[model samples]
Target: MERKLAAILAADIAGYSALMEVDEAGTFQRVRAGHQELLEPEIQKHNGRIFKLMGDGLLAEFGSVVDAVECAAALQRGMAERNAIGSESNPLQIRIGINFGEVIVEGEDRYGEGVNIAARLQALADPGGICVSGKVGKEVGSKLAFAFEPMGDQRLKNITEPIACYRVNFDRGSPDRVEPHLRNGYPTHKKTSIAVLPFSNMSGDPEQEYFSDGITEDIITDLSKISNLHVVARNTTFTYKGRPVKVQQVAQELGVTFLLEGSVRKVGARVRVTGQLVDGRDGSHLWAERYDRELTDIFAIQDEIAHAIIEQLKVRLLPDEKVAISATPTEDVEAYTYYLRGRQFLHMCSKSYMLLARRMFAKASEIDPDYARAHAGIALCDSVLHSWRYADVSIETILATSAKALELDPDLADAHAARGLGLQYGGQREQAAAEFKLALALDPDLHEANYFFARFFFEEGDFERAAELFEKATQVRSDDYRSAVLLTCVYLALGRRADMKRAGLLGLERAERELTLHPENSSPAQLGALALAYLGERDRAKEWAARTLAIDPDDLNAMYNIACAYLHMGEHEPALDLLEKVIPIASVHRFWWSTDPDLDPIRNHPRYKRLVERTTLASP
Candidate 1:
């Protein structure tokens, strides 16, 4: 019952009914000769499965989409050769539409829109030409040397969603027409934006949850690679996981034209996945499909789901979109399983989970030495652990793992981001910036790079640029308290009272919301204190700071927030006293510690100068 994507080719004779009316016996002979001499041989040669054969045409499926399209072109060219040799007749011609999509397999027959779309495409094809949906074009567009003419968007019969079409130009007189590459800018032509919600885990076992989440992330990653579409980052999308989502509301919140939601259930070696795309403007279903596949085919299933979603979005694929969507770090199911587990635990943002994630990533990389993503996961785990102040490993370990990841896959954005953070910590500022820039260039939607790079910018006393990045990071994931808290401080440093208040309230709201999620966590209390300090709530600021310190006595972030509160209360002595206590933490870096307006009351203090000097001396 597992559904797999196949290239469906629907073809029909150009004038079958008319040909039969003119000369029944002769037409039947001509058609039978074309079917046997041309169609069947080409189908067999290309490894195509002919599922249905009408008297005039046939429906075929191919595992390789490239082979299907090539076979069709070859068939046409061969038929032309026959017509040229047979001087008495105008050769019989056929119309074709090739589509790459998911097909539901019920016994020997394939069902679903995968075949239906091809049928619709066939109706649109010219007598001697082929029409390919965006779905098929994305897979074989750049792979084939044949030029394609843009057919634009067509609302075909019985198809609710308009199909973006292209015609393969094989004739010598028509020069191959190439569509202009979509340059990313404001108000892009790709008007239909979408946010794919994290797929729900329908499996009863909690451990299989990562499988569902992994599928969701893979779909998001693939969708994001399409140059035309705007896709929300994983951080923002997963916030709604396990929560009841109102599609229209989510679409409005995410500022998307569509919302994709689904569920995944894996039992033993098999999995069932269901997904639906909804139009955001009005809560109406646009496309829905179900995929049942064995566990080993998870990567292929992911590619299919991503392709299906992109097809529904009607986006013209970028030149690299096909490769990006199809790429998998490892073919080994066990290694892939371990990698998914690593990714699942990594996103939880806890030190113990991070450690577990690191171990899982190491195991995955060990099993598949060429696994680029597993190496990237290891790099991220090392960086997050150190940055979160649970530095179980040394700087060299972090550097080595990050370097190994980059060596394995220089194009991996996560590796570049991790290496950037390592270099930033190692005192190579310019090198760190270059790495961060490269990471962003590799994946502009990567929020980790934006967050870490913003920290690097903010720490160097560039409040304006730092604010810009923090704004972007928070936009990507507003519930991230660390980003909100830091953004609040950046505004404080720049002495923008109105902006500072706004950012502080944002921090306060995030911190307060997080209290419900992780009450024992110290970050919420620390952020709450900073937020209160800026809003002129001295008592609340002091209380939250005290609460944070009580939760974790070694919480330098709490101490810093307490210092900020004291500074606002005009108590220079205690602010300086708190600063002196936390100054020795090796990972702490605040160029604004001396220059920030909020810290001005303590800047002239004798202890402040010594603390700054100690940081300078300790910095590598």
Candidate 2:
């Protein structure tokens, strides 16, 4: 072997084996396509030579460290774009590490401490990030205009001195660029973000849709109980209803770190459910299983599913979360079926459906008044009715109903969530926060609680906490289009430019997809407008905004978002003009104006100040 000084590049799929197992042919095709189309071209463009390809990993050598580092960044950005539409079970993500050191080069491969160190550094990189050893950093420091964050010192497997590392922050041509902070030259930690897609209904009878949906809801509820995990809520998950979606797109739209998908089938007295846990970073299946059981053992089946997931994810179930699962309303199959039906209607989020849900919950409660879950269902329905202002019911009546449900069973997280929403709407901010906290304590997997907490944090001007909670909510339910869109706003508030761009692009893709899938829906059009605005596409943003207003003139969020778009584009006069029209409706409804970070650009403007003062006086 000939020893040579080189800039060694090491690259690997974050979760290769598991992804291949999930869909060997598909994963192989996508990964190979990415390697040939993007990675190879990038390396060549930067004057780097591919030394070898070892299964899902590769080694390359470059004469210049700057070129090697730049190539890694470009490759990752392209891969992320490609993976946006691929299957989550085999996502096209690679971790790249660069080091400047001596390597023993053979005919077609390289080896030595330099190669090993680069490989190890790849392991330390985030899914779409680059990690460079100190040697590489020092060599490129004066030559390139790249920002580096020191990760301190890392102890490699066989290296003597601690290897200092630096993370390259992706620069997309903005003066106010944000660099990723690192501890010891490596990303210190990663949040556990997950998206739980809707479970497929495979039962021969179409009427069993409710049963299958209930199973998905239960799994989501159970998973949200893990405080360490960010579970997307049912509202978000159900957005993918009746449409085929690739797992990678699901992960990107939801901004999740992981993905959970499953199918449910019921046959007469027997039910069968299959579930698989996947790593979103590279579409790897961490665990998969099928459960077969009788319909009479519905609660037991739910418990088994929850336990399997907990074990697979290695999440520690808190004592209270464990106890909540076992606290079922006896083994009454009829009552459980009624409760499931109620839950299905409740998830529909329509007034008529919720009324039907209330009747089903009443029947379940009548069958067993001591059923805490049934009471929780009633509480949820009442809260929804109150929120929608159905039949002009008093707020007091809604709160009372929610309180009764909680009184019947203090451990019912759903009841606490309902009460929290009711209290918050009734202007009891402190009590609402406390109730939300209690619900979270009772069931950490409660998506509603997490979502409300995110909103609370945003309203309190705590953008960092809001972003964290929003991220968690997305993880619990990956298909939630609203949360996915809202997260872009959170990223903007936190000044995470790369994250903002990634999220904005993901939201735009999802919104466009949704529009194509459901052409008549106005929401997606509005979301597309917001995304376009964030991306600095002023004309396109205005066009989409106009389309949204044409569909629904009274959409305050859309109206406000349009105003924000103008503000971001530096069209202050038009922005103020739109804001003047929006302030009245926002004040009347107290609709998220104070918490909207998009309005930051116009916050100090004289027009904004006058509008706020006028709205405050006009508000009741």
Best by lDDT: 1
lDDT of 1 by residue, 1-620 (tens): 67999999998987576567678898899889988999899998999989999998899999998898888888888787777888545468888999999999887788888998898788667667788887666676455665444444554545668676666655443332322211211111223467888898999987788888888888887787776666666766776777887887676555456788999998988989898989877899989988888988878878887888777766777667788778777788889989989876665454455778999999999999988878878877777666556667777887788888878787989899888988887678889899998998897657788888998888876665677567656655646666777776787777676767777777788889876666776767867887787788888888887787787777665676667667766777887788777664522654545555666566777776787777677554
Question: Candidate 2 at 360: error in angstroms?
Answer: 7.7
> Which prediction has the highest TM-score against the true structure?
1
Q: Rate the local accuracy (lDDT) of all candidates.
A: 0.75, 0.71
TM-score of each: 0.61, 0.50
Clashes of 1: 1
Off by over 4 Å in 2: 1-199, 203-210, 216-263, 266-391, 509-524, 543-585, 588-611, 618-620
Q: Worst lDDT window (10 residues) for model 2?
A: 180-189
Clashing pairs in 1: 2-292
